[model samples]
Target: MGLSSRSAVAIHALTMLARWSDKSLTSAEIADSLASNPVLVRRILGSLRDADLVRSTEGRGGGWLLARAAREITLHDAYTAVEAGPVLSRHPHPPSDACEVGRNMQALLEAEFQDAERAMEERLSQTTIADLVQQVLTIERKIGRSAR
Candidate 1:
């Protein structure tokens, strides 16, 4: 199980907001940079807004902005905001009652999947939007595209 593009887009939007620091970004602007539809940006923004990771404005000079400092936001926070289901999917097998292995396998699989998800969440919780922004800036600098 890999994360969806929505995860990448959410991370990018947050990183951009962090880099801008004081400026709000319109969905159009974020869509342009992310090479995705503005509607898609808005959808992701809606989830972020619900999570209190971002705040939206209306009318002129309006857009979206990070609701808090980047350092306070973890990747797991973002993931949790958008995650609709389990991190890993399990196969649904209706085992025969007479089969000993099949009858017990489902429980075992669920336990293993839960453990994996916990481990993944733990790792994600350790990284913040600030960390992602720093890595992105480093790459931009290495490629001579630093904002300076």
Candidate 2:
């Protein structure tokens, strides 16, 4: 019914990577900033890595790195990487055919859902992770808080 937090988490992790481009970061470190479980962060990171949005290494001095420049990565890319299904998935079971609204609801909403999905993807495509990082820093500066 609503946008999943996966997109938000992916964007946040990407922004953090962009802000700290000089160093690789562990899932635990990124998770701390998100105030989320490291397992969740790692799961997201795994998807990002598979999507070529991030790369990782193991051992001492090992951590995750941006696979490409922040400017080359789009929110749409991140969104697609983590989300497995349509932005608005249909109900688990179709409404009863006995009900007129229930029988036609899916058909009626399909186009609108498609349009919404396209618009969302288009918007996401227009903004890169670098843009997001800049936006965050700008907001912080305006509020007199240092971007960390």
- Where is model 1 more than 4 Å wrong at Cα? 1-3
RMSD over all Cα atoms, model 2: 1.8
Global lDDT scores for all candidate models: 0.87, 0.91
How far does residue 20 in candidate 1 sit from its true spot (Å)? 1.2
What digit string (tens of lDDT, one per residue) describes model 1 on residues 34-143?
98899999999999999999998899989999999999999889888877788777765577768898888878989998999999889989999999989988899899
37-114 in candidate 2: lDDT tens per residue?
999999999999999999998999889899999999999999999987788877678888999999999888888899
Would you give me the overall lDDT of model 1? 0.87
In TM-score terms, candidate 1 sits at: 0.91
In candidate 2, the residue pairs with backbone N, CA or C atoms under 3 Å apart (3 or more residues apart, or in different chains) clash, namely none
Candidate 2 regions with alpha-carbon error over 4 angstroms? none
